[model samples]
Target: MLRVKVAKEIREKEQLGDELKTLRSKVKELEKSLSGLKDEHARLAENEEKFRTLIENSTDLKYRCDLKGRISYLSKAWEDALGYKSTEMIGSKFSDFQSPESIKFDADEFLKELIDKKISSYEAAYISKSGNIIHLRFNVMLYRSHTGSERGIMGTAYDITGLKCIEDQLKQSQKMEAVGRLAGGIAHDFNNLLTAIIGYSEMLMMNNLLPENAFQSADEINKAAHRAAALTQQLLAYSRKQVSRPRAFNLNKLVNNLDMLLRRVIGENIEFFTVLEIDVGLVIADPGQIEHVIMNLAANARDSMPNGGALTFETRNVNLDEEDCEKYPEVTPGPYVRLTVKDTGHGMDKETARHIMDPIFSIMDPIFSIKEGGRRTGLGLATAYGIVKQNNGQLRVTSEVHQGTAIEIYLPRAEEKIEKKETPQRKLETEGGNETVLVVEDESAVRIMVGTLLKGFGYSVIEAKDGNEALEFCRQNKEMMIHLLITDIIMPDVSGFDLVKRVIKTHPGTKVLYISGYSEEEISNKGTLGKKVPFLKKPFTPTVLARKVRGVLDRD
Candidate 1:
């Protein structure tokens, strides 16, 4: 019995040993799992800290809000940018900081899109604590709680006000450039028509056989034609087409001559003052255009102050070096004539000044819209701008609302004296000798008038409707001596240049005189007309026509 009991006790001890071994294995596995969980928890904590650091320091105004638009949390950037403490902003409604004008009724529509389509971004204006408007681009997403319950909205707000201003300025500039081009083209065509009417009317008035009434009628026609001509000249000046025969002329002389006129134009209310600097040499510019520029600027100043103010015209010589040129791209490193027109009148703000030079702004009269009884068109300044640019000059303006405005016009000085040649006196001779001249013009009335004038001038003038017709005439007259080819530059079918080439080939010694009202730039762009080719801009007086023809004939 003792032996049996010893064996049973040994078996029981073995069972106990097995149970202890199992417990030891279980403890080791639990310890391994516990160590792994600690490592994971440490990594998670590091990642959370990294995320927090990134959000806190970002320039973007990161924030979280509940579905009711109440701010739940905001990054440090939000508080710093908005001048709000974290405690003040945390429970406040996001809409509280928005202006009534800035409230988005579209938010409901956007919310529906957010929930249904997951649309994530929107833009709107926000009002700051200081009442300044701030444009914000909000990149937002719908947030949910861990249990998938709708939590709130989170977003990053980016400031876009500077970018918006740049875009607006770019658009305004593009619009102005487009309008200027259109104005130029219309002016070019109108000037051509004016030339013909004025030229013929002057010829009629010179006739001695006409009765008193006829002479009176002719005089009336002349006056009316002159008025029309002057109008077109202004348009051309604005379009940058008026011939800029720039010469070094004394600015003081120009201003002095117009002193009386300026006073009269501005009226008795505004006092006109001149601060002329002595020995201010001549600026290289078309004097008439300069006069117009002064007039336009003066008019603008006069209109600015209905109650009247002081208008000062100052002149001086400026030497612009390389550094000055860098600041003004339009200015070169050379001598310039500086004319400043300053007025003690209502000034303009930055937004108005930015668009002041635009033709449309001038056309619409937006600048003068706020005045009690202002009479003005924005065209005066725009026209001045066109004139300055055409003269290869620079214009600068400075102004503040209610403080007044100042305009500076800088015209480059002529490097050397431009020699002036007197118009030669015409020698009188009997009309109608046998000189065969080919007349090529596109306009029927102009062609007829020119033919009649040529016949009266004693040339055996042959008429052709266009350049092609003129070429055909030249071909037919190849065997005959064609003394002159007077052709219009712009025409249907063959251009004036093409006709000139064919005529030169057919009649090697044919003298070609090109006529057009188009500007030199326009003609040159069409084809090469060397300086030697005599060109008479259209609407020429009969005397001009006769003289040019005689000059070309004498040269041949």
Candidate 2:
């Protein structure tokens, strides 16, 4: 019995040892599992903090919305972007922040599509706290629940207002460029026709043998033709195709010269003020074009203030540095002369101001003006805009509704001293010269008229119908002392430039004078005129022709 008890005790001890070892192994496994759970929790906490930092620090507007389109969470960027705090926007519907025209797609429909498509992007305009519209491009993704059902949307919005403005400006510029090309072509043809009409009319007026009544009729025709010529010049100006005869001149002086004329145009009701800067720098630009700019602006100001108001013209010298270049991208960093025109009349709103430079968008487009007995072509401002730009200058306008309008033009300063031009009171001599001259023109009327005029002016005249005839004449009369050659720039058989080149070889001492109805740009190159050759514009009176011929012939 003693042996049995001892054996039983040993067996129980062995079983207890096995059970204890098993429990110890299980405890070790549990410890390893606990350690892994703690590490995983710590990793998840770190990931959450990183995501929060990214959302909070992002420049773009980040937001979360429920499937119902209600805002649940919004980043602090909402305050910076729309002037609305996150707290103020948390419970608001997304549509509440959008303009009526900007809600292109329904919120519910957008969410449905987002859920069905998994992700989407689009553009919309949001209304800011100040009531200004903000353009935004959105990038969004639909968030899903654990059960694979749609939970909400996570999205970011980027501001695109500046880019939108630039795009609008580019589109408008392209439209104007197309119109300019068309206008230039039409003006070239019209100018040729006007030259013949005006020249012949003047000839009739000069003929003393004509009836007394004929003088008045011819004068009327000439006056009307002059007005038409002015219109053509305006077209050329707007198209940027006008040949600029740039010279150094004082802008303040130009303004001062126009003082009497500007006052008369503005009428008795309006008050005029001039603010000229002492020692204002001279600007390099076409004097005629600059005068037109001032006149156009003055006329516009007059129309704006029909009920009577103050019109101010001011000038000053300014130096634009790199900072100015950034502020005014159309201007360079250099010395500039600024001319400002300000009026205390009705001002334009943003929408109207945007299209102020468009030729057809005038207040006169409706066949009437907002004021009594007012009519305008709306091309005045546009011509000024083109002239300023072509001269490497900048024109800027600002206006507010019922407040007033202001226009600023900045032109580059010139290095040379300026000499103001004045018309001489002495009458130009119209006496005929005895020098032998050759006239070439494609138009029969123009050719005959010019030949008759020169003959009347006492010059022995020879006429040619075209370039071929002119070239043949020059070759045949190689020994003839052709004192001067006056020819039209464009001809059928040969260009005037080529004809001149060949003729000069035979008659080396013959002085050449080019006549043209074409704009300087049209006849500048492409086998047209030589750089140093003297030119006479068509539609000129007999007096102008005689003086030009004498001037060229007398040149040493």
Candidate 3:
């Protein structure tokens, strides 16, 4: 019995030992779990600090709003963007500062969907303290409590007003460019028809044998044709299709030369004043077109001053910079000639000013006494605007009702010195030469007219309707001396360029004169006529034809 009792006691002690070991193992596990919990708390605190720093220092506007649409938190960027302190905007509803057109999303509707959604992005505009619209793009996310219950909306807003303005300006410029291209296409064909009409009318008026009444009627027809020609030239200038003959000339000198004419045109009732800069920079442009622009602006000013008012013509040199480029986005940073035409007369209202800039808008008042005919096409300012743009310049107008009007024009300054162009010697004799000439043209009327003109000049004229006929004529007349070859630039079967090459091979000594209604830039290889080759634009008067023929024939 004693031995059995001893064995029972030993088993009980073993069981107690096992229980103590289990208790110690549990204590070690508890200590380790406590340590891990403390570390996790420290990590969470550090993450919260980093998030707070990001929100405070970020350039993007950070905000938090309650379900009632009241701002509970606002970033420092509020003051930076909208000129309102964070404290002042903290409790204010976002709708208070938002523009009427800026509410792109419904907050209540978006919040209702947030239980299943996490993130969204949208754009809105806010009215600043300065009364300017501020555009913003916001990236928002739903905020929630640690227990996963919804708290509110938190988002970052990025300022995008500058980008939006630039985008709008670019879109407008592209639209204008598209319209310009369409206008150019129409003008090119229309000008060709005008050239023929003007040429024929001038030829008829040159006849001296007509009766006095007939002469007067022909004179009227000639004058009407010239006006039509002027209209076409204006269209070509606006479309940038007209061939530019750019030369450096002083703006002050140009203004001086037009002073007498301007005074006469503006009338004695209007007082004219000049405030030209003494040493204004030179501008490179077609002198004729520049004069046209000046006259148009002056005429506009005269129209404004119906009764009697002062018209001031001013000029100065300017250096445009980055800020100027922003205002005139199409202009580059460089030196420019600044011209201002100011009139103290009946000024235009904002609406009238805006409409007048369009080429189609014209004011019709028969009793205005503005123009000689008292009928304005309303294209004067439009033409001036177009010419400036074609020359890589800028035109800006400002006006206020009963205050006055000012028109400012800026043209890029030319770097090169002005060089005198050589003029052809005058042929005092009103007679023709005895030189043999060949004319090739596709148009029957043009061909006949040219042949008659040359024959009347006492030249032995050879005519060909097409290139094939011209080439055959050359084959048959290989022995004949053809002193000059006047051909159209473009023709059927063979181009003028090809005809010239073939004719030159046979008649190596023959001079060539290329005539075309198309711009030299359009048909030439590098926007230049061939070296040593004479060129005459179509719609030439008899006098111009005689001078060009003599000039080419006399050249060594």
Candidate 4:
């Protein structure tokens, strides 16, 4: 019995040892699995850190909005592009930052489509903390939870505000260019017609053969034509096509001289003052046009303050460089004189200020004056803009609702001495020239008027209806010693400049005189009329025509 018990105990001990060894092996396996898990956790943590760093530094705005349109996440770019704090914006809906119009048009329409489509791209406009518009291009998709259920909207946005600004500026420039072209075309035709009316009336008055009543009637026609001519000139001025008589003059002197006139313009209800820089540099612009600009600003200031306000004119000399060029791209980098016209009156909002300098905007705007007679012609700030532009200057306006308006006019400083122009007194019985003159005109009335006036001045005269006809006349009368070739600047067949080029090749002795209703860039390129070549402007009286013909013949 004792031997049997010992054998059984040994067998049991052997089984216990096997079980313990198996348990130890299982423990080893578990320890290896735990080590693998720890490695995976460390890798995952590293990946999360990288992702967070990328999202924080990315220029593209990253946002996640829940199904209820409440924002859950916002990237750091949101704060960079817009003047808003990321923490402040994280709980808010996109509509909170959007402009009212953008909310009404963009979010309402685009968000509806996005909801239906699940994945889409769109553009949205948001107002910045500083009240500037921020345009964004969003690429969004509906994200899902682990269970594949729709979770929230996640998107990336690119700031497109700069592109939007460039687009708007391009559109405004195109619009202004079209308007300028239309105004210039109208003035060109109107000036030609006025030349005929004024010329024929003067011829009738010059005859001295008509009755006293007939002469008075002719005088009335001449006066009416002159008034009409003035209207055309205003149109030209607005289009930057007017014949400018520019002179170098101190802007401060001009402001001082117009102090009383400006005060009268603003009336007693308004206080007038000038902060003149005593050493303001000289600017080369038409003095009359500059005067008109001053009075127009005063008038506009007066109109803005129907009851009472203050009108102030400030002048200063500024030296512009690359830094200023960035701000005023239209201005050249050089010395300039700045004229600031400020009015403490009801000011314009951004919308109104944007279109304030557009031609004829005053006719549509309610803030402009309708008085000052029809002579004002509803140009308002537009006239000043054109005058400034034609004189190689820029006009900038800044205004806020109820904050008053400030208009800054920047004109380049002139280095050359101002040449005083001799204002020739009108002589009804001017001297005649015996030299031959060729008159070319597309309009029969102007042609006939010119020919008659020249013939009566005791000069040999030949006329053509167009450039082609004049070219033919030059071809036929090669050895005629044509003496002078007077032609219109623009025609359908050949231009006046081209005609002169061809005529001068054959008739080298022929002097050339160009006539046009309005000045052109081409005129400036060739040295303005009466510079390199003698030029006669249209709408001249018989005496004026006679004097011009004599001057050309006498100049040798």
Best by lDDT: 2
Deviation (Å) of 234 in candidate 4: 3.4
Q: After superposition, how far is residue 64 of candidate 1 from its true place, in Å?
A: 5.8
Per-residue error (Å), model 1, residue 490: 1.2
**lDDT (0 to 1) per candidate:** 0.78, 0.82, 0.78, 0.81
Full candidate order by lDDT, most accurate first: 2, 4, 1, 3
Which residue pairs collide, candidate 3?
A: none
The C-alpha local distance difference test score for the whole of candidate 1 amounts to 0.78
- Candidate 2 local lDDT, 297-335, one digit each (tens): 888888888789999999999998987775455577999
Distance from true location, Cα of 471 in model 3, Å: 3.5
Poorest 10 consecutive residues of model 1 by lDDT?
A: 369-378
Q: Each model's TM-score?
A: 0.70, 0.82, 0.73, 0.80
Give lDDT tens digits, candidate 4, residues 1-556.
8999999999999999999899999988889888888998998999999999999999889999887667999998888788899788888888788877774334445556776895487787999988888899888888888999878889899998877765766666567668877888888888789889999999899886799999999999999999887777666777787778888888888899988878877899999988999767789888898888888778888777777989889999888898776555567799999999998888988878877876657666555636434334357787778878889888889998887899999988989655455589565448877788889889888999989888887889999998788888878878888898888888777878888889899789888778887665536654344465777776666777777767767665
For model 2, what is the error of residue 339's alpha carbon versus the real structure, in angstroms, after optimal superposition? 2.4
Q: How many residue pairs in model 3 have overlapping backbones?
A: 0
> Which rank order by TM-score, best down to worst?
2, 4, 3, 1
Q: How far off is residue 286 in model 1, in Å?
A: 5.3
| Candidate achieving higher lDDT, 1 or 2 | 2
TM-score of 4: 0.80
